[model samples]
Target: MLGASRMGAAPSASEEGEGEPPLTPSTCTFTRLVAKMAADKIVPVALELGGKSPMVVMGDADLKRAVAGAIAGMRFTRQGQSCTAASRIIVHRSLIDEFLAEMKAAVNAMVMGDPLDEATDIGTIISKQQFEKVKAYIKRGEADGGVAHSLSQVPTDPKLGEGYYVQPVIFTDLPSDSPVITEEIFGPVTALIPFDDYEEAVEIANSSEYGLGATIWTKDLKTAMNAVHRLEAGFVQVNQNLVVLPGLSYGGFKKSGIGKEASLEAMLDHFTHKKTIIINMT
Candidate 1:
């Protein structure tokens, strides 16, 4: 029961921050304005920020489902330009070889062309700046000793040459601390990393500075439920990727952002301002 929905209260979104100075480039500008608003005893904020989300593939997971989840979770279908994109693929060491082989084939086969075309798998980067940023991130991944597998099909029509079309890319064998592994690369790029055990897998996935969204792939209900408890992301889905169901709240934790999005909780929890008035009957 939010006052906003029932009583005409204003709606504002800001991150839950600790009284610290804004540091992340992604949220600093808006954070400053939020701080100014707070100084005036005005709006309180709940921030829903960017994510370096992860997809964990257990050894017992269905390889096809896990690989398909990987492809979808990376947001490559949208040029990987989603804040909640699960860009980190943390696979069980036993499944890395097969996972990468399947992923490589799947990624390569996607046809990149006009968004208007029904057959096009994905389309252009939003702008020249973002286009270069995506390319730079790929290069940085290479410099960090990560091998990139670029999607083979590029949109090459002379008519559509002006579009900012960059093929999607997948990087493998990256170190845990590699920028490509740790930073938020908001492009059609993902990195494949491996871990030895369930504990290590959770550790790798939770290592992200941004805990926006995460997905775990497996057949075991026990593992899925266990992972749901252990993963640090705000939204952890099992056997699926990037799912936003009706009335389910979605948001980030840690540096990914704050507050909830798309649910009753957003109004009643984050955006609500409770007030009470009392008067004498005299």
Candidate 2:
């Protein structure tokens, strides 16, 4: 029920799980698995899948606030493990130096230790397997010609060093095609991609296979609106990090997934079906 390997039988609402029944099987999971179930006609799947979300920092952006927004988007609150995490930061070339410096400082200052401690900003990675996976991504990033800056330092104390802990890292000087910039690493790691102007920024953000969520930081209303019109992501945040509340649809476009969540449409998706009753009274 928890682990992917353990979740053998897909969740079914029907009393008898022998055959495919009329059920709404909503999932936010692996794309390949979803396709298999969909082909078998298991149910009308409402999938909310993966993301390689982006954060756009325009030349006119409020640098201070954008730094905060980028950090929050990367999920420093939970070590950047969220599906909607802003793994790619596309900033105007003019603002790259300032944005990167502030972002590095913000990540470096985060407290890393036991989650039970309120002061701790980041806890250990989910598990040793996940820990290794994230580490491998970091290595892959370096191999791809991305300059790495790690905020995580090996703790000197034996007790603090026991668990699967990794320092928050940011990669720069990588091309847009790098896997570290394109794939979902699902860790406290983000890639900084520099662009020349607004058009280039949108181009980089839209280039990803994922279109789940995105954020744009700019003081220019015109530029923000232009991005909103062009960026392919389902959920777009202007001047803020991604945050969804009740009554708002939360889902993605493209390979990111299908359908909606946390809104009335999601509830209706499962509860309602089309029924046509024709009666003629003569």
Candidate 3:
């Protein structure tokens, strides 16, 4: 059975099992449960888990486009809930200020309110529990010496209801060890880490234990390619937001997952097995 990793309170493995080996792709915690069951039954399983994706902004990047891409990559869809969201932004020290300013303005301009409304750009958190969790992360970030910049004032619209709506946040002046920089907030929040040069930038981008997705923004083709090769993410994007299209192999490295989906790899893993049949016809 196909299962999602990131969603909370998923169906139990017993409920989904039909006497066959199960295929599960869920959170790291949930994967543990699935792994136990598979081990007990001696069946094969697949798992996909959490991420703390990073977007690297090089000194030579086009500030205007990079800022827009960062905002779009982090906030435009699902309020940064996806595993592939570029929640961590590592930028060159020289371009950090300009990138942050432009990113702040672009994020502030987002429309947050009723999701049913056509004009809404940002939506509410999935639940109250999720809202609180995200808020706690924000507070933890501040305590860790990261300065939080509120991108939007809480909307006063009565029509928005009592849903778990949260303002987007950007943390700056943070060390690479900050919780905001290291953990996956899974909210409309992003952190900026300044690097002195290309080597430092690449090092910081790969510092995370989660190697799901990463993006590189730079005008120099050589620099972009170098980062694309060096970043530890399973999927690396260059000069654009992280997006998964049809027919592409989708999965993460390290703790991200074990198998890919929606591509040839998925077909091979879940649909077919190779066998060799030989006969002494000669």
Best by TM-score: 3
- Compared with the true structure, all predictions reach lDDT values of 0.77, 0.77, 0.77
Q: What does each candidate score in C-alpha RMSD?
A: 8.4, 8.7, 7.3
Q: What tens digits encode model 1's per-residue C-alpha lDDT throughout 151-247?
A: 7577668988888888888888777877677777678988888888999999989887778889898889999999999899899899999678889
Q: What is the lDDT of residue 171 in candidate 2?
A: 93
Superior candidate under lDDT, 2 versus 3: 2
lDDT of residue 114 for candidate 1 = 86
For 9-60, candidate 2 gives per-residue lDDT tens digits of 4333233343322121223344557667777986676767778899999888
Candidate 2 clashes between residue pairs 3 or more apart in a chain or in different chains: 152-167
- Give the Å shift of residue 267 in candidate 1: 1.2
lDDT of 3 by residue, 1-282 (tens): 222334554333234453321222335566677889989997767666678888998888889988888887885558777777788888888988888888889888888877888988888888765676577667767877889998765668776668788888898877777767766667888888888988888888888878878999988998887888899987889989856799988778877777777798888886687789989978
On TM-score, the stronger of 1 and 3 is 3
> TM-score for all predictions?
0.86, 0.86, 0.88
Q: Arrange candidates by TM-score, highest first: which order?
A: 3, 2, 1
Clashing pairs in 3: 5-26, 5-27
